[model samples]
Target: MKNLGKKIIIIFSLLATAIYANVVAKVYPKNVVSGEVATYTLTITGGEVNKPVISTICGSNVLGTSSQTSIQMINNDYKKSYVLSYQFMPQKNCVIAPVNVEVDGRMEQSNSVKVTVKPAVQDKNADFVVNLIPSKTKLFVGEPFNLQLVLKQKKDAEAVDSKFIAPDFKGFWVKGESQATRTEEGDFIITKAMYRLAPQREGNLTIQPAQLKIATRISSRDVWGGFMPQVKWKSYFSNEGHIKAKPLPNNAKIVGNFTISATADKLEINPNEAVNVTVKVVGDGNLEDIKSFKPYIPDVNVFDEKINIKGNTLTQKLAFVSDKDFTIPPFSLAFYNLKTKRVEKISTQPIHIKVNGAVKKTELKIQRDDSIKTSEKSLHVTQKREVLSKVWIVAAFVAGLLIGILIMLFVKPVKFLKKEKALNLNDEKLLLIKLLPYKDKDEEVKKIVDVLEANLYASKKEKIDKKILKEILKKYDIS
Candidate 1:
């Protein structure tokens, strides 16, 4: 009888525990390739609980987490449940460690999960193959190289949908990429994409594999005894690539063959007028690494424009405004010449400008006429001098009034004019034009201008926040 009583008590305790709470862990898509994202969910039911603090999952970093809660009326009792999900990218196959969740002031353990992370698969018998090939794997920093992605497919196999995911290209600057081109090679059709890469840092870097997802169309019989179209999707991955970037010589900012030249619109200008000079650098290497040329001259107001890069050429416009003659010093660019296998320097000729209406200091001399001894003669001379002074003063006043009137009528205040020409934030191209002048002066402006320019000119497009743009315009009083 005592044994029966103990059994009854044990059953009641188990039922109470079941009514309190339960925790379970689950992983979706049990098998995945390395570098693929997988979802791990921890479900807690029948009680209140705190968020689970999971440091890692499947020996990989957790990218992010989210939670969802729900309430259900089961058997006339309110039952609450919580589901917490974690997103992680697994690099290898590993077992997920069990996590403990605190529920109603008590800790409940969850079951472990096993995940299979296999290396990227490339089907040998597939209809298509992709490859990532580099022009040269070994190079110096700032040296540009070509990386090409090529895909070859059988002409008979037609895909209904296709997407190509390029490598991340970490630690390297993507100078540019060419549009994909298709050509027929014997029995196969070939598609190729070329990218220009410049290493930003010296090290051994790995370029992750690129992926191509394709969907092929197939026919299936429907219930109506008619053929229906079906789609089957498959993914193909390219082989990984490695790059060994060696360090450049100390203080070597560029690597390639380049030439520097300067030209001025006019050698002579009036006082306060600007001398517009263009400094251009033409090269076959990493032209994007070239910095803007800022010529330093005392008493000269130098306004350096943003650097403009077009293919192998870089151009920077500079305005030097001064009341006196000043020399636009020669600009020099130093680069490691790949052909010569040595550091080389190129410089522009110094340009000397002449100010046509510059003011010059001259000594004035005063002489008294010793021959004028008579008082009447002296008085007449003094009256004549006074009359001349009055005439000069009147003439000066008249000229000043005319100039002020002309300025008021023709030239408006810069700030007021800019406000009047306030830009529509929605018009990115116009905003880009307005922001270009300020890019060299402000870092924030430069960043925004870069994004806008990329959206308009480059193949890749980036999102622009109107609120942020408006704030920047307001901050700079650019309207």
Candidate 2:
């Protein structure tokens, strides 16, 4: 009977201990970037009908609590849960502080949480990635603008909604939103927000709450803690906020239009010669529209050459021509000049060219006196040829007289003397004939025979050169 009473007492003590452990409120997930909404969860167990109240106060320059949310509930106990989300847009960087989440605003039985609002980490492939197209980091007022939201999900992640709460535009509005596209990289990206600014005001603004909800993966493994391991939930907050666009200034500065100017090394030129006209484009705005100055030039035929472009400076050579007097007119300069507060129109001075005559017309014609002198010189050659013909006739007369003297001396009264001369010649010939019959070939007889043959009978018409005579004599066996 005493053992049964002891067992009853042991069971009562164990039941009473489990009765007191009730509602617990905790704030977790410590790291967060500015403008990211974070969730704080409340778990209650072993409690009666006790109402719970949650409130928050945002830190100055750290977080603004004025815009934070609040909620109260009356039915609790038996493992009930509650969730609240808030954000901190830190004005400055590196201010690590704690946020106050008051549960019933009392410390005795109430709970409080301390968290750090830090910067966000860059996530390369996020579920809902906000893309600033053309990513024009630098913008002007009333500029055509657009933004793209890229959503990537694994097969198990939940569907996303673009109706998520977003920032407020104080001085701007969206111009258009492009059709969404699902790229092969497994992403659904829809271009949104073609924005432009209103006429004037200028200041930096923020897109308050850019929110996105995505499914979180759950795993099963029992652990001992206040964490409630198996409990599953989905939804979220994103660090990528919206449009911090500033309006262009009301009194913006205006830049001047490009101007073209002409310069020459010198103004004078010879006829049929060339002069170079150089045009320099100086100043700002679009320098591409300036045409070649050659076409606009008059009297001068401009030559085109390869243009030299260096940064904003443009230069090229222009060559011109004319036989008579001509001028290169000054070009007009029109630009939105910042000085003098108006568009200025200016003209350059006209350039003058003097071309001297090359050859006089009188000098171009042939003279009659010179033509006659040259023609007479040509006739003089015929006159000389006529005189040469008369000389040849006199030479023939002299040759006939020489032949007549020879014939007269031998044929008439000179016959007796011819017979006597022949006898003398026969006697000399006898010497050669006697030597030929003997074939002795003595050096003295060889010399005498060579002289006789050269004078009397070798058939070649050219002068009997001594070399051929000597060789013929040697071949006749006469040394």
Candidate 3:
């Protein structure tokens, strides 16, 4: 009977332990800013537990999870527990969904938790501030200006590491300096960055805010084994602004203060030789807007080249060729000067060139005797006249007629007529067919066609540079 009582007592002890098993969940902070991480914890008591499986939480993402199990004897009583921790990033404010878990052999769920996320805000207690500044708030299209970003911090704040986010410059072309400078202003430390911006179009444009994330060490103290330093993190944002870009005047290709000058590589050259003419434009504005340049000189052929830019300077090279004396008419460029607040034209002086005449071909001749004296029939003995036979005469006439007919059909008459017509074609007519896809908007092409037409109909024949024309056609992708 006593043994049966001991068995009942053991069964009651097992039941009591099972009744005490339970699971609980907890979340820290309950509020955070976007991009900051939050944490969640799950604790299970009195039994073995499996890893918690969290359902999709609204407005937040789960980054990772970790777990630990432990047993201890406290006050002469045995105790066991299982714990799980989760880290997450919140996108916005929302209620976190209930988390699920399995403890021993039974399923359990935790109560839903609410989390709040706020937009980025300036910290009044922060040790630093960021400012974004522009040289000008209004500009003309194709005009250039400066943009600067400055970071100001307390002199005692040590910035161990930092991250910077620059604004997106839409509808504008931007170039940044390679180096940044840091300076001290009284009790503040300042770091500055600079960029050059050129407006690409005319309209209202917005410059987004710039952000800076900085990590700094504030203090240090001696610990158990070593000195421990305290670290703090802070983020700063700069104010955003708008810029207005106005359009340039019609036919005005440049917008800034600039000077233009041109020169020829040779003032005297052979008719078939070529000369390189270079035009340089130095300025503080956008040079890409000026696509091409043309000299308004007739008779001289001009082939333009791609523009080369070096810093604030733009250079264009042209190859000129001609068969007779000609002048490179004054070249002109129109631009709007912001300082003068008016449209101004810059021009280069006329260039006079002397082209040597075409070389004459000299024919080579071979000397030989035209007549030969024949022996007079062995010194006048029966000199029989070399009389042609009737059959021979007929054969000779037929051969001569066949040769004449063949020459008319293949050598002289038929092909010569077509060649004469081709030679009569004027320069403009030839270019029309050769330059199949002529761009009418291109000033250089239009000027070339005008000069060709003038030379064709004018009373005095104007020199034509066939070599330069061919080069121009080839440069424009013509066969």
Best by TM-score: 1
Query: Candidate 2, after superposition: displacement of residue 61 in Å?
Result: 20
Q: Please, what are the lDDT tens digits per residue for candidate 1 over residues 33-108?
A: 7656688998797576988788677677899898878787788987788889898878788888778888888888
Give me the runs in candidate 3 sitting further than 4 Å from their true place: 1-125, 175-179, 216-234, 249-253, 270-274, 294-305, 321-329, 352-479
Best by lDDT: 1
**Superior by lDDT: candidate 1 or candidate 2:** 1
Ranking by lDDT: 1, 3, 2
lDDT of 3 by residue, 1-479 (tens): 99999999998996765455366666665877555556777777656667756644564557878776777565797778777778777778877666666766878766667888866565534677877788998888988988888888888867889888777787787743537899999988889989788889989988776777787777655322456776555557676657898888765768888888999989999986898899999988888788788665666678999998877888999988877777787777788888888899889998888887744433433222211123443434433322335567889999999998888877855566664333233546666565545747565566566666666566545655677666566678664
For all predicted structures, in order, the TM-scores are 0.55, 0.31, 0.48
State the displacement of the C-alpha of residue 307, model 2, in Å, after optimal TM-score superposition.
52
Q: What digit string (tens of lDDT, one per residue) describes model 2 on residues 1-479?
A: 99999999998886664344233334444554555545444443322233433343334332322221223343562343333333333322333233233334432242455556664443546555543333443444433344444444444445533345443445544434455556444345443543322212235544343445443445564222233333233333434433443432333322244566788766666786776778777654323334565655554577878776554566777777776667877766554454444556655567777667743345433687788888999899889999999999999999999999988877777655554332123343454564464335556556666666655566423333456445544555433
The clash count for each model shown is: 0, 2, 0
Show pairs that collide, candidate 2: 58-65, 167-208
lDDT of each: 0.85, 0.49, 0.73
In model 1, which runs have C-alpha deviations exceeding 4 angstroms? 1-28, 35-112, 121-125, 156-158, 216-233, 249-251, 361-479
- Reference-based TM-score, model 1: 0.55
Q: 2 or 3, which is superior by TM-score?
A: 3
